[model samples]
Target: MPTQQSEPLPLGDTIQRYGLVSRILHWSMAALLLWQFLGMGLKLTLGRTPLVSFFTGSHQMVGTVLFVLILARVIWTIANRRHRPAHGDGLLGLAARAGHMALYLVMLIVPAAAILRAYGSERVFAPFGFQIFPAQQPEIGWMVGIGDALHGELGWLMLALIAGHVVMVGLHQAMWRDGTLQRMAGRPRG
Candidate 1:
């Protein structure tokens, strides 16, 4: 009798579903983005309460981490573009593609703006107790201005986009009975 060997799990995406690396990046970013939104929402509703303070205190660091993750995700996405599931052919598919592009654009922009502001601010940009950007003596007005203008506004916009994304996923599951969520969240297809 011959011994049989099981195949290894995929690290990159396949036509059927996202692989381990893509799933990890997707879920991890989802969690971090949720934290960011929750903190900001609390700050808006409750002002300076201890709970809000706790969330806000870690905001910069979390944002920095998100920035890095988004960069990695972009790279990974480009690498796996040819192997991933298709968006389908139709207006719906076009919308899906457009929606995802918008999400990626805002995701990249939100943190990048904040980082630019931090780099140009009078105070040092220290996250996790280490300085990545030193304080500017005079402060760069344009950098700070662009960041201040875009960060909060675009953040809210991104939240709205995220809500739409979730609603669409629900629609796919409920109306179409499609395994759209499974592409990213479900167990690997055998």
Candidate 2:
């Protein structure tokens, strides 16, 4: 006998049906991103203080968490992608995939640059002073300077990338309306 085919899940129903692991990762990442944004946003407007210290630590912590979670996500995606249900791979889908790839690249690059910058500066910037990234002696002063410049420029780049991500999501939701957003909107597989 042939294998049975499952029905397609309805739009707007993805969020309520996301698998446990998927939901957990999704919400955790979302929450951390929110906090990180808040931390950075405040740092831009608000002056330094004990409160800023708290948020900064939180932001760094969130960044660290994102690194680990993204690593896990990447591993999980690689390991189980074959088992994942198939979806369209057309133009809009290609755009979505490319956009996500860009996001992940920016995500990894920005933190790494920050880590290298911290290491180059011998700052040992740790979350809550825990020394997450230890100092390292690189080639020369130019290496350190380059790391710092890259780190700062990447920060600006990340700001734009984030905005682009939001716009893309909005476009997928508003313009496409083809279940692109719904698929990842925490919905369950049918």
TM-score of each: 0.94, 0.70
Instruction: Please state the error at residue 43 of candidate 2 in Å.
Output: 1.5
Query: Taking the candidates one at a time, how many backbone clashes does each contain?
Result: 0, 5
Q: What is the lDDT of residue 69 in candidate 2?
A: 82
Best by lDDT: 1
Where does model 2 exceed 4 Å of error?
Answer: 1-18, 83-87, 128-143, 188-190
Q: In model 1, how many backbone clashes occur?
A: 0
Which ten residues in a row are the worst by lDDT in model 2? Answer: 10-19
lDDT of 2 by residue, 10-57 (tens): 322222343445546656876787777777777778967778778876
Candidate 2 TM-score, true structure as reference: 0.70
lDDT of 1 by residue, 98-167 (tens): 9999999999999999999999999999998988899999999999999999999999999999999999
Whole-model lDDT, model 2: 0.64
Q: Considering every candidate listed, which one attains the maximal TM-score?
A: 1
For model 1, the superposed segments whose C-alpha errors exceed 4 Å read 1-8, 188-190
Q: Report every candidate's CA lDDT.
A: 0.92, 0.64
